[model samples]
Target: MESYIQISKINDFIFCPRSVYLHTIYDNFHKKSYQRTPQIAGTIAHESIDTGAYSSRKRYLMGKEVYSDELSLCGKIDIYDLQTKTLIERKRKVVKIYDGYKYQLYAQMACMREMGFEIETLKIHSLSDNKSYILDMPNEEEWQKFIDIVERVNNFSVAEAKILADSKKCAQCIYQPLCHPL
Candidate 1:
């Protein structure tokens, strides 16, 4: 059976498939999560977005939830400028454009387009830097890349996943403590 992927999780999935599995464990159990300052800050930064309080203008779909039946993916988009045909994905900070970020944006655009939204412009807005990176829409091949990720995630299982214990990537992960257990 295929997994019902979340557009927001495309970033986490690329960052580490195992982390996604661990995160699901937390969510399923409703465990108390110990978050660092950055994690709390990021959540605080998204308060408005989570509540859909972005713009008063009708041209923008602020904090709107979109679903893609084809991909079995769903997520709330930060901002969709209907007038400009732009979809903006906001982050707490962004010093560099990573593949994880790009894939998340691509997944969002693909799902939106499938839902009949005009999405010609792709963008990522960094709150810390107050800068936006405008990107071109993903092509068919790019969309296929995201599709491949979805398939991998569907096949991924906690028992079958490998834990990269000594990877430097773990240092940057919020779930490192739970994942590594000191």
Candidate 2:
């Protein structure tokens, strides 16, 4: 059986493919002990959704595990609004809606649509800022870009100094010690 690409990896893969490469090579034991401020904040913000508390009241799907055999992608979506047919992803905060996020949302949409779920809207809610951003549907060309990114990650190779990593992204990366892209 072919292994599925994780939906969570879409952001990391776009941020820096090396992060995903380092992720696959290391075990969860090392990652378990690794916690940064942003990750901690993200976890804290997700508590309600993770425990299905938020969905219970709204009649929504909280932390729903979605998978697509066709796309070979799988991960838990934060919230699926049954009333609105919206696939909503929440973050601790969102200063700017980055491309990585848009791509991640696209991947989620693809997975959900493939799994026979209704998705008419895509949104990202910033928990801290209490803000929400709506994403426009990607054209075929844009969707193709995401597919190409997945292919790159699926066939990823570890090579030092070859990754096109930004200095800002590299500094914030959790895998900096292992990847050392700086």
Candidates' C-alpha lDDT: 0.79, 0.80
Score candidate 1 by TM-score against the native. Answer: 0.89
For 62-162, candidate 2 gives per-residue lDDT tens digits of 88888888778888888888889998899888999888898788888888898888899999999887999998888889889988987776676666325
Clashing pairs in 1: none
Worst 10 residues of 2 by lDDT: 156-165
C-alpha TM-score for every candidate: 0.89, 0.89
Error of 2 at 11 (Å): 0.8
At residue 55, give the lDDT of candidate 2: 49
Itemize residue pairs with steric clashes in candidate 2. none
lDDT, candidate 1, 77-158, per-residue tens: 8888988999888899999988888878777776788888878888999999899998766678977887898777666777
Q: Which window of ten consecutive residues has the lowest lDDT sum in model 1? A: 27-36
State in Å the error of residue 148, model 2: 1.4
Residue 99 C-alpha lDDT in model 2: 81
